[model samples]
Structure formats: structure tokens, C-alpha cells
Target: MPPAYPRSPRRNGVHYANAAMTVLLGLGSNLGDRCDNMEKAIEALAGLPGTSLLRWSTVYESNALLAPDSPPMWDKPFLNAAVELSTSLKPLDLLAATQAIEKRLGRVEGERWAPRTIDVDLLAYDDETITTPELVVPHVGVRERAFVLAPLAEIVPSRRLPGTSETVLQLKRRIDDSLPAWMGVVNVTPDSFSDGGRWLKDDKPTTAQLELLDGNYIDIGGESTRPGAVDVDSETEWRRVAPVLEYLDQHFSGRLLRPKISIDTRSPTTAARAIEAGVSIVNDVSGFANRAMIEILAGSRCDLVLMHNLSVPADPSNVLPHDCDPLAVLRSWFGEHLEILERAGIARERVIIDPGIGFGKSAIQSLEIIDRARELMEFDCRVLFGHSRKSYLESMTKVPPSERDPETVAVSANLARRGVEILRVHALDLHRRFWRVYQRTA
Candidate 1:
């Protein structure tokens, strides 16, 4: 269990007694001025009778759901949040107060899961369950709701819900990982495992990247993180990658539709700078191990890609003796590291998990990771599959990495079938075709 957060300063009108119980509330908005509505709701909750806001979580954006009674359709993205309150009010009173705050914030009558200016649902109260016609203690579907559990974990990962053994962190990781995102590969290194020096011009990268692929997004990496590749200093890596990001940021402005940009780096300095340059993600292969890296990422607004890696090259001679379950080890590693992130206030939704296809794993282990990618959803963050043109595919196909596009595409489709969220690849044309055909079938 994680340590409890210390009591915070009290609000002007609310007095929190030492005996006050801590409660967690889920707040969200999908309609007009979402962030503003959430702020208003937080202010309202802070002054509720016998309640003081102890802490609030960083907001997370997630796909909204359509009304169950209405035809299935994708709604606007919801800005979701979690608030911890130190309160002495009865559960019913707290619930009524939150509902009143919603109405006051201009939440009008609407169908279930419909867009709202503000919505507050009582998540958990004092580890006690009140089963009644009007209320459910643990929140009817909180245990399985990733959007709710993720923000809740951000503020209080160790908190245990009433009548359940899982803590907020555990529940967050165990929640079903939904939402699919694609990532095109934009290799900028001179020695990338495949496609080395092809995109190696000092010119702007917006054109190079846009010309390379068109899909959900593109991952821009400066250094070659292939097997046995050497580490580059942060300055050198930034020099190679910053220009691309700056150009992309400028080029995408005023465009109605632009792909998301992800920066792949292991250096904390590079990650921080790339985020400052407007990259939406930092794909770190070190599983966010370094404290500086974690701190920098926590302070930035970008989503994180924490990949399981050995932090060094994989020498075939150093193979495990026997009976080592790589997947199990990776899972435990993620569980521990993710706790550290949550304890430090990193929102769980702002992360994606990568099994590290070839960072330090053997061909067999890499194959196992692909076959079992869905199992990684146990970590809750979106699972990213980066098996494009890797050595593992070459081993299976007996072709050089550059000629492994077919193998890569086949494996990607399989991973997609297994519910993987992000697919990093070089064959954008084939994937575009696949998406078109697959969407119709899906």
C-alpha cells in the first residue's frame, strides 16, 4: 500500500476535523467549456457542508460514451477528474450536494452518458458500501471504468474501495484497456535498424514525415535504439529531433486535421524539451525508471510510453538458464514502477505500455510478447505494439529487416485483433489499406 497523502490546507468556509473521513468523487465534463465547468465543480465540492477538498487529480481526456438507449455513436472527448475530500457529511448528504453542484453548473436533463456541462458521481466514501435504491457505495461500475479508476489512481492509488481487495492503483491497472491509436514510425537516426539514413536530412521533418506515412500519428525518434546501439548525449539527440518537432508544430497550425506527434527518447532532458516543442508523447524504452525522467514526464503535458527494457544490449550468450517467464517479470516491473508514478501524481490515463519488442529480449521472447500482448492490458494503459521490421520478424522470415514489411504487417493485424491500441510501423500504405478493410469488417 502507498502512503496516505498529508492533509492539505483548509478552505475559507470549510473546516476539516482530524476525525473527518476521506471520500473520493468522480467529476467529468464533455460539453461546453469542459475545463471551466470542472473547475467550478471542484470549487463547489470544496465548500460543501462538513467537506474540504484534500486533493484533486490532473484532468484526463477519454472518449465519451453515447446514451445506452440511443444508437451507438462516439461522443465528444470527456475531461475527467477525481477529487479527494475530507468530510464529516453523511454519504447521502454528499451525494445530494454534488448533484446540486452539477445542476448549478448548468447540467441540464439529458440521456444517460449524454454530453454534460458538468457531472459528478460519488465514487467511494470511507471504504463503506451503502446499497440502497438511490446509491451504490463503490459506484455501480467504478471497478471496471478505466476513465474513472485512472484519475482516482492518480490522486490515491493505495486507497481501497469498499468491499473489494483491490486498491485504486490495482483497480486502475486491471481495468479494461480500451481506445485504439495508431503511430507511424519516423526514424531520424543515421543507423536505424531498418531504413537508416533515408530520412536523414538537415531540412524540416514535417515534409519528410508527412510524405512517409499518413494515419493516426507518427513517432519521431532521434537516436537509433536498435539492439546494441550506443546511447547519445541529450544535446546531440535533441539537435537531431528538435527541428522536426518545431517544424511540425508550425506546419500543423490552422490545419483542420493533424496527426498526433510522439517523441521517442530515453533522456529526461530530451523528453522534457520535446514536450516543450509540442510533442504529444514521450516513448521511453527504460520503463520510466530514472527519477529525473519520471519527474520531467510528470511535469509535462505529454502522454508517456513506458517500455520494458533491460537498459542495455541483449547478448545472446547471456540467455537465461531456464524457466524465466519474461512476461511475468515485465508485468511485475510495470506494477512496481507504475505505483511510483501514481504516488508522484502521474495520471494513469496519460500513459501507454510497450512490451519492448527488441530492446533487450531474444527472438523467442519477442514472439511471446506479440502473442500475449493483450495480457498487458492488465496494466490498464493503452498497449503499444512496436514490432515493425524488428529482428524477431527477420528471424522468422529469413529476410533482412528492410524486407520484413510483410511479416510486420501480418503481425500488426494480429496484434490489432488482440486489442492492441497503438501500432508502430514503417508500412503506412499497407496499414492504411488494412484499416479501411478492417473497419468495414469490424
Candidate 2:
């Protein structure tokens, strides 16, 4: 197990004197009962022991900025408002109190882009600059997010960002707030067809795993659903992934921008455990078939990657549905399954379709999905293509999985050009470097 983390600010040597300071907070909600949720949070905020509401901004409705790289689906337009308050609690404690309100209002931390009942963002704290691993005084996204600023400008138009002369209005008009999504793959199984066990250290992410996963999003898994792979029991799967989630919550708790943690498991038990441990996205190969699985997402805002799968039983023996075009079949599968999710209260905008690249595919079938992914866009949600280091690439390039970095990059570049919303990958470093180069010169 990783080292235990101190659970309190005082233990970490941060002093929150019995001092009261005026603060700015941004409130938002998109999930169930949006306005009511915001009102509930407002009431809770005013009721905080050391806090008194001074002023609030007009509520604004804006499209959710789904972070660039990982789009399980689109996000609902958020209703946002900012408020000014005087609080006697320290900054960190104030944060803790706001988070408690979020939890009380049934907001479960899942994905970075997941909608919620209420979101309380600490925009600023009495002009006191704070830069710690866990908390930054001026919320990092405040400048770039027009949703935050439009409402903030309503209350305090002349507010300045920490360490900057620009007012909120100036920063809002001058910032490029596009946050790209990067999907970093983490497999805990010993037998992933490609990089199985490569990133695991004693069933938890090693130091190397941590270094490579220092990106925007992480797709974590316990079982390897490779071709002809045997199923591990749900208990075993939960055990493997739970510790990884714990490591993320403990270690990355202090980063300025934390990766949105995702759990790539089909078992409802494992998925629920991951959700409890702060995972936001579900990469289920079973296509979220069971009500138990969908119910795990009930009342909580979580992202779902509903990939197409037929399992190892139909693995390329050509004994499967040879009747019609596979692409049409997959599209029908999406239409039917998506309707099921919608009826079950899961939004289409919160689901990304992956046409199961290697699960029951020939190299040709996988390539077809890659070449013609937008057709699957008929579901009206973002399409994700997870062809990262799969056997189909080997079928095309005849190289070992480890040596397929160039091939993987080629696929990713082509997909980006073709408008794929997200690309899942085992090696984030190579793609990240290539992306940097392309951005510099493109």
C-alpha cells in the first residue's frame, strides 16, 4: 500500500488562524433539479459556521466545456452563478465545508466533466495568494471559463485574478480556455494483449505509472478483456482497482489540475467501488448491459463509455452474424442500447460509443470502425476510438506491441484529423510529446 495521507490541514502544517476574510465562490449545477440544487447550495453556504453571504451574481446558462481529450459524451449546459461572502474559516476549511454541502446534495465525484447537483468553486480568497499541492487560492479555471466570469462579472466586474492586473472581464475576453482531453490507459491485469502488467507495481500504479499518467485523464482497469481472456470475479477485480483509486486520491490530491480518473470495469461491484473511490468515467466493454450496472450511475453524475462487444465467444471464427454489414449492425446496437440508457435516466450526452476494437473483431473490422467512425456519430454523442496498441495494429504492421508507438501515433493523428473526440492509449508520453510538436507547428 502507498503511504497514508494526513487527513487534516493542521497535520500538514497549514495554519488557518481564527481570521475572517471575504471570499468569492462560483456555484453551478446541471444534473437533477438544477436551480433547486443551486438554491440548496446557496442556503448551505450561507449557513456555514464562519460564513455570511454578502452578494451574489446573476445566474447564467452556458454549455459545459467538456475538457478536450476525454469525451465519454457531451455535457449538459450548466446554470452558473457566483457569490461574494465573508468567512472566518481558513481557505482549506472553507473548501471542505463547501464540499460537504456538495456531498449532502448528492454530488458524487466522478469525471472532471461530469455534471453535478451543485459545484462550489473557490474563485478567490481575500486577495491572499495560496499555491499548494491541494489548493490554489484563485481557482485555476476562473480566468479561462466564461461561464465562471459571466456570472462573476455580474457581482464583481472589477475583480482581479491573483498575481495579475487583469480584471475578471479582461481575463475572460483574453484567455484561451480550451482544455484538451488526454486518455492515459492503466491496466492492472497481468495479461492485457498489449501492455499488461507494464504499469502496475504490486497491483497499484508504480512510480513509473504515476509519471506517465501525469496527464488530463486516466482509464484504469483491473481485468484484461483481451481476446480469449477469462473473466475475473468481481471481488478480485474490485480489490485490484480500489487501491489504484486510493493512490490517486491520496497522491494527486494536491495537483493544480488533477486527471479525471476513470475505471474500465464491467462489474457493477467494481464500478460502484471505483465511483466511491472518486472515479468519474466508466469504460465498460459489456456495453452497460445490466440494470445493476446502470443503477450504479443512478442519482450520480458519471460518464459512460458504452463500447460494442460480443465477447471472446465470437472471436473472429466468422461464426458470428455474417448476414449484414457489421457497421450497420453496430449502429443498430447503439440505437437500441442508447434508447435503453435514455429510458433508464442516463443521458445520451453522457455516453461515448467505442466499437469494441479488439474484443470480437478481425483486423479488418477494427480498421473499418477507425476509418468510418463518424457514421457511428448517428447516435449524436461523441465517438471514441480505442485502437491503442491492440492486436489489429500488429496485424497491419507486424510489430511487437511495445514497438507499435509509431503505428499508434499514426492512428491517433489520422483519427484527430477525421474528428474522433477521444483516443485511448497505453503510452501517453509518446502521444503527448507528438501532440506538443504538432501544436507548436500545425
lDDT of 1 by residue, 40-62 (tens): 78877777666666766655556
Q: Evaluate model 2: give its TM-score.
A: 0.60
Candidate 2 local lDDT, 1-442, one digit each (tens):
1111112223222222223788999988888877678877876777777666665644445666678775656457677777787889888899889899999999997987877788988989998989988789798867778678756653465567778897664554454431124578878777777776776656654534565444556788888776567888998887777767777777765331245677898889888777766666788888887789988875456678998877632265542254457688788888999888888898765677888887666777778778886577555565677888777786678788877888988888767655465678867888877865664445
lDDT leader: 1
- Itemize residue pairs with steric clashes in candidate 1: none
10 residues in a row with least lDDT, candidate 1: 1-10
State residue 62's C-alpha deviation in candidate 1, in Å: 18
lDDT of each: 0.72, 0.71
Residue 324 error for model 2, in Å? 3.9
